[model samples]
Target: MTGTATLLHHDGTEEIPRFLGAPGAALFGCLHRPAGVARSLVVLCSSIGAEWKYNYRREVLLARRLAERGVAAVRFHYLGSGNSDDGSPDFAALVAQARQVEAWGRAESGATRVGYFGARFGALVAAAASADTDMPLTAWGAPGTGAGYFRELLRIERVGRLAEGSAAFAEAEEPRVRLARGEPADVVGYPLPPELYDSAQSLVFTELAGTAPRDVCLVEIGGDGSARRAAESLTERGLRVHASRLVEDRSWWLHDADWRPDETRQTVRNMIEETVDWFLTVLPT
Candidate 1:
């Protein structure tokens, strides 16, 4: 199913909301189509929890910008997130979902070439989904390991409880204990199941199997060296990688109550411009 097209700009770029996959198990997505025929399509994978909410607007702008540059882009939510169906998907299931979206984007956009763009946790998903395929990839602020990312989520939950003047330590430990008992844990509002948590804990990018993409761009936001290390590791595996560092505020961590207009604008612009430029460079003619 699809929603009415909303004109994004006078340049003939439009955003169409869509529901892909089987009925009742559909994944929610927005397809941004360019004015003319697009030879390429970039699928935007999103991080979960609060990070997904924070990056929503930026991703919308990124999709619009890609469409404006004659590249179709689709941003979608996996199962149990956003407007999609409700179900806890494990890490491998998440990767499968991304691959499904990539195929759907290509068929829906009629783009001969397809690529992936993901930030934070989504970066890991994108990389895993693109394995054994020739699809180009752009990953920003990807965590080195799933265990670390899961721990960070727990930390966020703890910090949030502390800010509320509650028993932060106990609340934080509760989730780990629940997961240990083979149950789902509510980590920062996301109900993470034990299977997903265990799979995520073993996810290490450098240890991913299969062939890597020929073209890759690893972006580091706020001078974090993680992206550089990821790029180096991927390079050692025979992937051609471009590492870029952006000096901008961490807008994804900022809440609406702490919104800073100028800083947010700059961050969005830098991210969009860098991504669009890189996409255009590697996009097949």
Candidate 2:
């Protein structure tokens, strides 16, 4: 096994199947427990979109690293996506999933301190899940709110089809149309669950600020130029925010992969590493 692969194996390993509390069925995944079960557990939620495919392996690798560092970690798919129980992908269920992960991580590992690492929609879900649950966030490219995130999606489609003129928006099948209708619409073949869309639009950061965390909430940005720029508004509430980028990862929803991904992963690796380091520094000893 490679050095990276060794971190996954632990002497007291326990398999908590379906432990992450995915709302539906496809949420089945494992929680790897290493020695320091009493420390902190990192629950990871993935970005919901095509970008998921690009970083799936990298996410697993980072989770494995967390296991090696003595923090038992749980990585699972949200409802409607991943292997978890598939459905129309309800946002509420997905948020609850993160809570379930935090709940289970504390219970199974005997750890009181829990941290969440969420990407894209997963990051939003993590934020919601952590609310009132007392978990701090280490989010990567989490959208400002459900509405902002939704707008970014439309921006991509709009920019891509601009040459098609306003005619693109004229079609009944257009994303903007489906969004207005509040139904599941395919975005490059990936189903955009309506419950997710409307619910996201219904939320704001203030509503998301449920339980206050200790101090800093670590945030990572993708190399999606305009998108990352927009993500900065997350810092508005005076949260001690650290901004960084994952170069190898591009905006997954864009019609054309307009980014250099290898550079993006470097940013992700640094973000994960620093997140762990910060966790060690800030988390009470």
Candidate 3:
């Protein structure tokens, strides 16, 4: 066994499922190690709620593909999500978690470097993390700010509730929403505590004062060009940025039954290819 972790599985590659961070509140993580020497290790951050449910398959595929390319990868649950312990996942703790996981991946795999790849809300977390630490990063479908994300979550929740019935709101008590204050807000089946909201409201990427990672890539799923704008903004801040766009007809983050099997598979393939290719291109010769 590597370190004190248990070997969870061994199909084509070895998977280590373990807990990390301070005792009594450990975050669950699955580390995928290559059969040979790893080129690098990357932590894949996930979006929350329904997005998380739909994107799990894609993330798993990406991890396996990375392992096949001789790169170690980690897919972990944030403090309060998935298999992790119950606790409010705040921005500070998330940033710290990314940094710590990066360091741990480097140590565990003996890789020359460690990087990050985040999707949706996870992309924002990755960007904020880049401001705190220097590392190669890939942000896919990232928003401009945390407050915007908070609003999006609320919108999603409202739409979901409305689909049930018009009288739903009238009969049921709603979760009180507050910004910049520590309060419990349950949006779309996820319990978000006060610190998370307070920190999220202040996360404006363009307004951030810290420097981003030197190597960065921003990808947009469709033609909105938010990723392009973010790339340009980061370039203006003196950070090298690469941008790309992929065609997506609908929101893959949603749990809609409208997705065609072939189209969904192709979309996931495009994302994995673009992400892995960028990592390979940026590696030092």
lDDT per residue, candidate 2, 1-285, as tens digits?
Answer: 001122334455444555243233445555766655457777878777665665566567666667666777787766666666667757887787677666766776777677777776676777777776455667666666788877877666566566567776555377766767876777644778877787777776434643453344535454445334433443554444555555533343342445555335465567667777766664542
* Pairs in clash, predicted candidate 1: none
Judged by lDDT against the true structure, how good is candidate 1?
0.80
lDDT of 3 by residue, 1-285 (tens): 123455544545667777776665777778888888876888888887777777887888888778767788988888878877777868888877776676667777778877788888888677666565567888778878888887878877777788889898666455543433456766777677777777778787554422754778888878877887887888888777888888877776776567655335777788898788888776531
lDDT of 2: 0.62
List the RMSD of every prediction in angstroms: 2.4, 5.6, 3.0
Q: Rank the candidates by TM-score, best first.
A: 1, 3, 2
Question: Where does the lowest 10-residue lDDT sum fall in candidate 3?
Answer: 1-10
lDDT of 1 at 192: 78
The local distance difference test score of each candidate is 0.80, 0.62, 0.75
Q: Each candidate's TM vs. the true structure? A: 0.90, 0.75, 0.88
Q: Model 1: residues >4 Å from true position, as ranges?
A: 1-8, 166-173, 249-251, 261-264
User: Compared with the true structure, what per-residue lDDT tens digits does model 1 show for residues 1-285?
Assistant: 645556566888777787887777888888898988989999898887778877777788888889989999998998988999887888899898888877777887889998888877888888788778778888877777889988988887877777866665554567888999999888767677887888898888655522654788887776668877877877888888888877754455446566765335776688789889999999963
Lowest summed lDDT window (length 10), candidate 2: 1-10
Error of 1 at 231 (Å): 1.8
